[model samples]
Target: MRNFIILFKKEMKEGARSGKWVWLPIVLMVIGISQPLTNFYMPQILEMAGNLPEGAVIEIPMPSGEEVLIGTLSQYGTIGTLLFVLAMMNVISHERQTGALAFVMMRPVSAFQYMASKYVAQLCILLISLAASYILTWYYTNILFDHVAWTLMLASLAVYSLWIVFLVAVTLFVGTLLRSSGGIAGVSVVFLSVISLLTTLLPKYMEWSPGNLRAEASNILLEGEWGSSATLVSLSTLALSVLFFGLAVYMFKKFERFGE
Candidate 1:
């Protein structure tokens, strides 16, 4: 417990120094807030950009708050996911390259404690950034569009966080297995993309895939109810997170053994 806390604090400090504390949330806020703004001003934007006749006005129906939020989430599914993968790509790789990992392992720290600290710290920063971005977007959504229920908004956030959790676990596992940051990011992105494609191609078989987390979150926002599919996705995501983290620990232990 003591070692975990110390490692956690160290990880947090490293995150702060790297500016992960500042940049990611701000970038995501920009991405999130842009959705409602663009949707609300589509007609004006179109008029300014297009050389249409004076009497001809483009008519675009304003998206509902729920749709606006989902649009924000779609942005997250692409740009945000890429950003997150980039942010975490070097987390473990840097430590290994600098021999910091070896120095830390020479101490009394166990593999689980070391990896868990990294896991928890990264997860906290990512989740908080995502929440801030989503909440700010939700606020703008209410003002610009129809009001979204707080219960529904928060429920969707929780549901979507599970996807990030799974992502982080996969990242840690890959980091432990691979020595290069580019390899880590490439493998992680490819894996995520493949799973998402599989989910799209085989929806019936891949119903419980973590890739379906965004859709489930959108469904929660639009429908405002927890169905069996939502529950299944949640459980499967949690189980996969644990599994990946465990593999990371085992992989890290082997690295430690091999180094000795």
Candidate 2:
């Protein structure tokens, strides 16, 4: 436990120093900002274009402030999720290639401890990224609406955090098994793409598969009934996260460090 804490702290320091935490928030900010910016200007932008000749003056209604905020969260939330997927898609492979793992492995830590610490570190990064996006969304929305559903928004953020963890676990598995970051990223994308294709082409049973979990959440947030199904999917995704992290640990154990 003490070793884990020490290693985790080391990981966090490296992440902070590398400006690694900046990418997701920056992408999310653009997404969040786009909502208000577009809502505020879109109508005027359309109106300024001198009266359309005919059948071209599409009636574009200005979005309500609340609606803008929700749109921001949903839209930017997805962009942020993709950014996280890209960031986490290279956990172990990069470390090994750059000799970063050698420094830690040489120290008296067991392979399990080392891998677990990395997993936890990735989890922390994902949580922080989600929290940062939530904060930005709340701040921006409050500026325009002056009143927001803090509880519901926060709950949504929490549920989405599980998805980030799941992706990180998949990343860890890829990074550990593959020797190159490009290889890891390529494999990850291919696997996810196949899952997505299958989910679309297959029957209802495959609908709730892991690849479709994020899409399901978006549906609930945007159009569907947020009932038992959402809760079930979130729980199932979290369980899969645990399983993937464990698989990462097992593979890390099989890895022969400091050798060919």
Candidate 3:
């Protein structure tokens, strides 16, 4: 526990130095805030950009707060995910190349402790960024669109965050398997894309897929209640996260043995 805590703090400090502490939240906030602003001003934007006949006004209907949030989430699913993968791609690989990982492993820290610390630290930053983005987006939604209940917004965020958890777990697993940051980023993106593609092509079979987490979150916002499907997906995501972390630990142990 003590070793894990120390490593976790180190990871956070590293994040600060790497500028992840600044850029991620800022980019996500921009992405999240843009949705509401864009939806609220679509008519003006169209009028200014479109070379239509004079006095021809565009009647753009405003979307609900929930809908705006869903747009924010879609941004997270794409750009946010890519940034996260890039941020984490070199988490371990860079340390290894620099011999920092060797020095750390030479101490009393075990593979489990090292991997756990990295996992928890990265998860904290990503989740916090997502929360900030969601909250700002929610605030804008309330201002520009209909007033969505705080309970619904919070509930949807909680559900949607499971996808982030699953993402970290898989990325950690891939991080352990590869030494190149570029390769890690590439493989992680491909793996995530394949999962999403499979879920879309085979929804009936992939009902419990983590890729459906966004839809489940949207459902929570619309229904304002935790549905059975959300429960299943959340549970499945948690289980898979644990499984992937365990695999990462095993892979790290093998690497340690080879280094010895």
Q: Tell me which of candidates 2 and 3 scores higher on lDDT.
A: 3
Give the alpha carbon lDDT tens digit for every residue of 1-260 in model 1: 99999999999999999999999999999999999999998899888897899899688877789999999888998899888999999889999889998789788888889999999999999999999999999999999999999999999999999989999999999999898999999999999889889999999999999989999999999888988999999999999999999999999888767335
**How many residue pairs clash in each candidate at the backbone level?**
0, 0, 0
lDDT of 2 by residue, 1-260 (tens): 88888988887887787677887667666776777777667766776776767656556665554566567555644466566667776567667778887777777787767777877887887687667766676676667554555665565566566666777778778887888767777776666667657867884877455655555544544452465666777777788878887888777777745222
Candidate 2, which segments miss by more than 4 Å at Cα? 47-58, 64-70, 73-78, 142-148, 200-203, 211-226, 257-260
Question: Where does candidate 1 stray beyond 4 Å?
Answer: 258-260
Q: In model 3, which residue pairs have backbone atoms overlapping below 3 Å?
A: none
User: Which candidate has the top score in lDDT?
Assistant: 1
Backbone clashes in candidate 2 total: 0
- Measured over all alpha carbons after superposition, the RMSD of each candidate to the real structure, in angstroms, is 1.2, 3.6, 1.2
Where does candidate 1 clash, by residue pair? none
Better of 1 and 3 by lDDT: 1
lDDT of 3: 0.91
Q: Cα deviation in Å at residue 121, candidate 1? A: 0.1
> Candidate 3, after superposition: displacement of residue 40 in Å?
0.5
